[model samples]
Target: MKKTLLAAAALAFTAGLAHAGDTVRMGTEGKYPPYNFINDKGQVDGFERELGDKLCAMESLTCTWTTNDWDSIIPNLLSGNYDTIMAGMSITDERKKTIDFTQAYYPPAFSAYLGKDAGANIKGVVAAQVGTIQADYVAKSGATLLEFPTMDDTIAAVKNGEADAVFADKDALKPFSKAEGGDFVWAGQEVQLGEGIGVGLRKSDTALKDKLNDGIGKMKADGSLNVLLKKWFGDETPTF
Candidate 1:
């Protein structure tokens, strides 16, 4: 993993979707393990949870978590269903058109292809979460794309013989690949894409954006962010 801080985006999104609430609502897809998920306790839990909590504390903001399906996560944010999107959402110019993003907390990592056969052809059927960059890639790469409403379904497609493989953030898919034993392996070379993940806020909420950025800057300076990244993903993922 390359150790670096992704630059802050010089942009704003949804200037009309301003938020005013006592509690910061952090929306997530609670299925991306190591990043965000519902633990055995049934509460929102994972690396982002810990990091979001820390960031909220830094800004002295009260925060609450909401789990939503991945496909509608961004639209929900725009609709004021939540105050911010803290899922493992990568910062991209396309997404920047819909919502503003903070400087990346996690640097961009590789997009991995996982499958039952190590020799699966890249042109074979590929499964990816709907509305993801991975899905878009497969659609344009000549591979038949089988879009799922969630990440779990994408993996299920590969497991159920519906897809030759699943494509997603390498680190986001690490736990699944490992848990699949030898049934699934990294089928092809990894591809890195987009800016890293960040906290997504409405464009009108620059105040909230600055506070979160300030918190992230403090964590980067004190090495706390690095510690959390290492804790969740080991030394394999890039850190601040």
Candidate 2:
């Protein structure tokens, strides 16, 4: 009886170990600047990366990040190709139907960039990259929509007069606008986009979702979240 009880206890301990150290694969579009972009050394580095690292550390889980295109990210997550997504995806009603999201990690703000000759007639003008929230806004708002695979291409389209304007997160647009001298200008006020950014997880993975949220709340309370935000956005805390 003593030996049997010891074996049962060992089995339970092994199960707990398996549950605690589970590895989570995170998906990201490594093209979005200051969020999850690829560095010159061919490594993924950005705000999302830092946040993911912290979450994994806090939760005692191993994390692996996979870089993928923006359009296929959601499908990939749903297919179980990854365990979660830390791609700075916003929590939207449309997406909530398909997957669950953790508490927001960053705020959302939208801005538009126009070419030198382009006036502020944003109506009917093509703006935003494909598969992005800005593109969704353009489609729903009856604006002429132009889609590009990457932010660089979208910026190039505006600079070369191919597209009238490009809309994206304000933080992502700031560096490009500054580099353009008088060639480009931000038009209109920065619009409050939505309820910040969050980690996207599979709908059935409620356990992992709870863990991520708890980790985020701890990060917020300890000021680690703010430290990471300042590293990426300088003095500005993005509007959530």
Candidate 2 residue lDDT tens string, 1-240: 999999867754443333345788778889887888989988888999888988988998898878988878888776566778887687888899998899898866555555443365566466677877778877776668888888888888777777777778777776776453435777655667767789987766788889999999998888888888888887766532
Name model 1 segments beyond 4 Å from true. Answer: 1-22, 178-182
* Each prediction's whole-model lDDT (CA): 0.85, 0.77
TM-score of each: 0.89, 0.85
Predicted candidate 2: what Cα RMSD to the true structure? 7.8
Q: Write the per-residue lDDT of candidate 1 for residues 163-210, one digit (tens) a residue.
A: 999999988787777564445788888888889889998877888899
Clashing residue pairs found in predicted model 2: none
Q: For residue 28, what is the lDDT in candidate 2?
A: 89
Candidate 1 overall lDDT versus native: 0.85
TM-score of 1: 0.89
